[model samples]
Target chain A: MSSEIDIKYVADLARLDLSAEQAEKLQQELGRVVEYIAELGEVDVTGVEPTAHAAQLTNVWRQDEAKSSFPREVMLANAPGIVHGDLIKVPRVLPSEEE
Target chain B: MDLKKSTIHALSRNLKDGVFSSEELCREYLKNIDNRDSEIGAFLEIDRENMLNAAKAADIRRQNGQALGDFDGIPIAVKDNICVRGERCSCASKLLEPVKSPYDATAVELLKKQGFIPFGRLNMDEFAMGSSCENSAFKQTKNPLDTSRVPGGSSGGSAACIAADFAPAALGSDTGGSIRQPAAFCGVVGVKPTYGRVSRYGLVAFASSLDQIGPLCNDAEDAGIILDAISGFDPHDSTTLPDPAGGYADAARKGAASGSLTGLKFGLPKEYFSGGLSDAVAKVMDETIAKIKALGGEIVEVSLPHTKYAVAVYYIIATAEASANLARFDGIRYGSRQEANGLVDTYYKSRGAGFGDEVKRRILLGTYVLSSGYYDAYYLRAQRVRTLISRDFEEAFKQCDLLLTPVTPQVAFKFNEKSDSLQMYLSDIFTIALNLSGHCGISIPAGIDEATKMPVAAQLMAPALGEKVMLEAAAAFMK
Candidate 1:
């Protein structure tokens, strides 16, 4: 069973804010899903290799040359906050105490 | 002549012969959308001027005797998740509400190269997370066949547009059963190519491994045409398979010409037909099977024992990857943002406000499974079982050329009918395993349920890179 605390912890890990009501609801809902998926435990997969991707692709190499990219203006057009018309702005990271 | 009922091939012929100009065709479709979209809600956004301008260009090219190909000047809708240059690619999510794509997805670019003008941005389940269009943050897309019921999703809008004649055909991405399920509900043909058969560049990430872009169209041959146009290798997406020598459209044409499937063998998994199937759908399946047998195809009983675990296995791996993939949507980037005191608050506020409930639930579930103690038990175990499911397909394929199954347990259900998330998840039971196995599948309209009059569909799945055979069989069945 997934406790409310566990659901809250997972929500934090996912960088999502859940209201107490939402967290409680998800605790019950996701607990059911988790319990259902536990059926996989009955399968014998001792020697089976886990497949991250179905396609058998290796690293594809290309010529080491610069190609055109989306224009700076176009790329920055959708940025929530921009500085100097080209750079994306973000909230400050370092704390005043660290400084 | 109602252009809405016409196929791409037929429309292409009309354009080449100058029966009417591409501009006229575009205007006609735009007018149709204006008339009908209020009720169906298929298109999330329509670029009327852009579509008109492109249609005018296609007409000019035709007048100059330099038209691109048979498909030139035909307007097609695109699911909003696929990026079109200079257009919004929202994936029907609030997080991407402010984002406009700077470039085209490789598939869309290829269609443009063929002089195909993209018509509209269709709606979908937000972030392609749910089984119904109700999960779309924007609006619910109603089933064209029955307005009271849902258009199965996350490609619900893509399928709905085609069924409503808003566009001749559309592109959709399937992770689990998004494309096929909706296609089944809407009585259109949908195809999910073998994983990596179509390039994934410019498509917003969901479950990277399970996600594939496919076409939903009125019939199998049109699906082949769209599939041929969008398929092939792109340097931008390394997972794409090298271009195959013979195109899927060509194979479909050949199969249609042959007029028989005398030597073709189709496997029917007993597990699919045994339980959870509604009588109406089973009756449709029986008729479709008989039709195939009459076409000289042989049906053999085969078992995919792990089929029962598909939905469970799918949720774990898909959500885990989604949790990781969606972490990039921080407020600092191009989506809707919420200002807050600190970085952590910004992340929380933006995501909490941006994502719908289903997306949040899946993300939380994903985070739980991939977290410290649970990784080995849930995430790793699901991955290993995914391999076992893939092997089940391999074993089944050894006995037959392709496998046949029901696309869904029943026809389209009414809005708010399946309030339970687990029940909604179970709606995709028959179609989910194909994604896990990395194979190709198509859903073609089989029949309409007598009681509800909604469409029922049958699915055909083939092994990896077996699109030609799969499409040929579909063409034969469609004929």
Candidate 2:
């Protein structure tokens, strides 16, 4: 797991621009967290079912359909910066964005 | 008529009886907040105009004999993560800087319908991510009891505001102790209802499975009233239990005088006291146990063998779920969008710039755990351990009516004490197990630690939907 993780790789995947300082700090922190989690390697789970939630719950979902939504103006009014009519615009995506 | 130190139940009763007006309560609390919030940083935003209008409307309803709910004319505070219509719900993160909720969260709607005049959003750890409120991107919420220490968090603001008497009652979400832990720290009562008991609709998702909205307040009875008002099955959240809603407030009020610890078997998990606990905490807890025993409660030592794995298991599952839940926040929908010419840049710039450090760390860890090669080894294994954790509780409950544990190992720490991520994670050890077990948990101020003079919380846990029994036990402790 420690092939000296490429900062650019994670940054690209996360859509973040890491200042060299922040990257250095994150690289250490992330590496430590991953290594600590790797300690879970010692636990043995041969046949246990993976429980998604603690509750003995299943098939909890709302029907798919349009329900109540907030007023359009109120929703759009909150945009720090917005566009004409229906869209809230933003900057174009960069090519090096994560997959 | 100081609203800061009063209970919601008291304030509401007074308002109904004309002992005081709703407008007066609102004005008093708003003034208190205005006076103190700047230094304590407990509030994210306070809407003076909206708050006044709501209070005035509540007053009119009262005059017309049209009080909406028991909480009408009461000022309530909410954690930042819960949505309030047309109001900014930042979740204590810069990512949602200017983000406003188009609709109110179900809990918020319930409060409004009950005639609760919403005051303002409280601060919390960014995206409900940390144990100490320090992780909030905007500002840190300090403990009202001791300013140097943290207000237990990610509901720190909720707890602190209530503790400082800025709000009579506040709503907080508990995912691995967010509500209860802070309640303990701030010397208030915090309840995390049984999983599926409360609707999660409109709550900003944290760890979806662990997250449940509950109340933090001055007394268990008030917590009960708030819980009764906001709880029940919601079509918006299918995870809500199908059981009928009952009056938790009535249970609390009735139990206050009659509830006895007599014949109640309290489960004491050996794991909770083994090590890592402070001496002062252990002493206070044992003394409290003695007090309960004197009151006729029986203590039985029980073992949750899988307790050791709870922290490890929780992080994997919570972070994995969080990774998925937070994915929707990528700039295109409601928040800031970082710009680039292509699609990738947009996603990258928005998330990269939008999310804070702690959030990024979780996303990265979540992605890694759920990544292809590690999915079976990490994520799958964590789930299996989660099952074992739940089993431990099930087994313990068979011998005891309720389980007792410390809310956290120590009192609230200094803001900078937990710079290391692992250290911060460890602080959640006692609280996370319940989240994994999915039981109802509540924290009440046990007493102050003699040395540090900070509050130590006594946690009470009951079997699923055993909120009545839980309240009974907490009421006994308070008495």
Candidate 3:
């Protein structure tokens, strides 16, 4: 019912560096898109069951088996930046709350 | 032996008859890429040595009287997202620029086995995200038909290369009309086969359920030939269907002979013809339906009332999948990593710098949808809408053998016209419904829109695993 959205909050969530100009522009566009989406609320879906896939497939899977993987050297050779023992180094992170 | 302007079907016939050697055909297309790729920006990488070597082997097989599969010598350009051993399979993104495929995608293996020489990897939108090829990190591919405009993307390079006569046929993955939309924009034939009809083992995943690898070629018959070579059940791809009917070329040939749409029903979804469709496109669609009717077919109006929600539903599902799929691309695994004080910074910096803006947008959107507190409301609800969209098609197919619609609302828009990303996303509206339904579809250049002189595509969609029927209809239309 309300057409208000926090432009800066959404942009921050998206990791986009929106300038004042872009934020204003996006505010309008995003509002329209969201409004259009909200229109789906008008459809009465009381009795309908949610469908996850279009095709009727269940437990479609391949058996787990040992298969050859690319050689460690070849695999690491394609890495953008690699270090000792075929390991690729990157920035470390703080543990999450669950961790 | 030059494959310029030659279809895969024609080249296969010539090769079988010994009209030219495989090596000769491979060399000519390689030379064409060398001569024109600078301006056209088609190929991301050309494997000259391996291609010629493969072509030579095909020649030796011919000399030894060893039977080879159809199109033994014809060369094909593969979209960079599909893997080729030791070739840079970048997916047109800087994040994956330094990576080379350790193994071949199953489709590439099948293509090699069939005696078709590998052309090279063509450009695409970064991570196959954009509608126009402009998003490719390497370079923008100019439309071969009209150099000033974009070749439709994220398969723009594939379509442009074929249109420019660089490669007779090409492989492209469609998720939200990546293959068909570009094909229409560039005036080529592109098919998005039924899900599981072709294996997706080596294709860089964008949206797993929606992504399907298919052919982009100069004509529908050539597309069928390429599909025949690449499609089959693969143990590596759990989604692939186990069936002998994957031989689309033979099915198409047989279908053309005996199959007629004489009594078949076709639905033209009312929503597809509504607002935002250009007059030029509308006129061409009318003419195409007239042609189909002239061929003793019937057309009927149908309702896909959920059509307007397709773009939104597609973005939600596809981006959510993309968010999950692209998590594998973190710098630690195989891509460019930036150093930060800690792991969180590493992820933030690596992805922020490595990924393009559009990709970041989708990733963020996806992350939001799948995040805690929002999952049930956004992700769950979108799934239900997706079901409704698919059900609409299922109900419609009960009446119509195929559904016809415009591939895009308009012809190829100029690079400047789509500055707003939402506008660009709207281009996939016509194609996304087919993807959501998990059905087989193709876009054949119906005719040029008389108003703007740009090409318009007639989309043909059939039930799941109905590539044979779709191709049959397309070939019939071509004839």
Candidate 4:
């Protein structure tokens, strides 16, 4: 029902950093897309069972047994960030209580 | 020796007759790529040693009487979105530019099992996001037919690659007409199977529910060859249809041999032809319909009242799924990373730097729709409209076996022609509804449009799991 997009808040949720200029440009662009899609409101969807996918999805079952997997070295070879031997390392999650 | 003037059926016969070894065929294709691909810009990487080695092995198998099948020595170009072990599956985005897949996609694996060589990572829209191939971060792929125009996208390079004869056939994924539109633009055959017909085990997810991998080839029978090899259920993909996959190749051949459409009823959806179709494409459609009628086909009129809402509904669902699927490409993963001081900043900075402008826009819109206070209106409402869209198809199919429509509203347009994002989104209006309904559809060349003098094409749609009939109809027309 709303056409305005809060680019900053949405970008935060999306984990994407955007500058003021980019956000302003996106404001106008996304606003138009939002307006266009707003036409879907014209359709009466009451009592309509939402079709998530066209085909019915059933759970694929398998035996509870371990299978041979890719080697740790092969898996670790592609890690882009810092890795401690076989593990990938990330920046500190918690911050120091410095003023 | 000419790759452009060839087909899989002809080349397979030649290979079996000892006209040339698989290695020689491989070299001819490689030679063509080397000489012509620089201008076409279809391939992201060629892997000369790997392709040649595989081609030689196929030759050795044939010589030793251990050949896998008639298609033993043929090669297929792969869209970068489909994983090929030890090859870069970049999806033409900088984020995953350096990452090499540790496994082959289910479709690629099926191709490999039949002694078919999979080579070259074809270009595409970043994460299969754009309508024009221009969104690719690495390089722009031009229409092989017209250097100034786009080849269509998400699967642009997949279509252009086959059109230019860089490969005998190529694998392309269609999430909202990526494969079919580009195939139409490049003047070739492209198909999107019923949603559950092909396994998606290793395809990089774009919009999981909407995505289906299909083949781009010179003719309909070649599409059947690839489809026969790659389809059926796979445990790796839970959504795969539980059915046996084969007989497609023979069906196509039989259709072509019969050369008649006497008993078949084709639907002309009145909504599909009403708006936005270029005059040239409309003229081609008129001629195509006349040809079909001449060939003993029965044409009937049907109405899909919800056709106008397909584009709007598709973007909501597709973007919502993409926003979730692409979240795993954080700094710590196997792709490019832009590390910052803190963990949150790292996530923000890495994603911002890695994604292109179009990708960022989709992510933002997706996040907004799924955000608090908007889920029911945008995401949920769109899904309900999707049901209406499917119901429209369901009602139309009751009157006819297959639907004939224009694949695109216009022929391939010049690069940067649709600068506005919404305008680009509208380009796939006729094609997107089929994906939402989870039906099988194909685009086959009609003729050169008088306006652009570039290739224009027609689309044929069959019921869900109705590929046998659909490919037959396409093959009948191509004959």
The top-ranked prediction according to TM-score is 4
lDDT tens digits by residue: candidate 2, B202-278: 89998999999999998878888888888889988878888887678777776677656898999999999999999
DockQ of each: 0.76, 0.50, 0.38, 0.84
Candidate 3 residue B156 Cα shift, in angstroms, is: 0.8
Question: What would the per-residue lDDT of candidate 3 be over residues B1-479, giving only the tens digit for each residue?
Answer: 45556888788777788888888887787777778878888887788888888888888888888848767767888999999887888898888888888998999889888877666889999999999998888788988766778998899988998888888888999999999999999888999988888999999999998899999997767778878878878888777877664567766675566545576677898889888888888888889899889877899998898888888888888988998898787677787777766766666667767788678667766766676666766677888888888889888888889999999888888766788778788778899988888998999989987666778899999988788778888877876
Clash-forming residue pairs, model 4: none
Instruction: Give residue B327's lDDT in candidate 1 (0 to 100).
Output: 96
Index of the highest-lDDT prediction: 4
Local accuracy by lDDT, each model: 0.89, 0.84, 0.81, 0.91
DockQ of 4: 0.84
Better of 1 and 4 by TM-score: 4
**Between 2 and 4, whose DockQ is larger?**
4
Comparing only chain B with the true structure, the TM-scores of all models are 0.99, 0.98, 0.96, 0.99
Candidate 1 recovers what fraction of true contacts? 0.79
By the DockQ metric, which is better: model 1 or model 3? 1
Q: Residue B368: error of model 1 in Å? A: 0.9
lDDT of 3 at B145: 69
Error of 3 at B407 (Å): 1.0
User: On residues B1-479, what C-alpha lDDT tens digit does candidate 1 reach at each position?
Assistant: 48665689889988888789889888888888888999999999998889999999988888998999888899989999999998998999999988999999999999999999986889999999887799999998999889999999999999999898888899999999899999999999999989998999999999999999999998778888988888888889988988572378877877878767789899999999997999999999999899989999999999999998999899999999999999999888689888876778888999999999999989998898899988998899999999999999999999999999999998899999998888899889999999998899999998989999998999999999898998888887777
Ranking by DockQ: 4, 1, 2, 3
The residue ranges of model 3 lying beyond 4 angstroms of the native Cα positions read: A1-35, A61-64, A81-83, A90-99, B1-4, B255-260
Candidate 4 residue spans exceeding 4 A from truth: A97-99
lDDT of 4 by residue, A1-99 (tens): 679898888999999989889999999999999999999999999999898987767676877888999898788778875455878878878997891
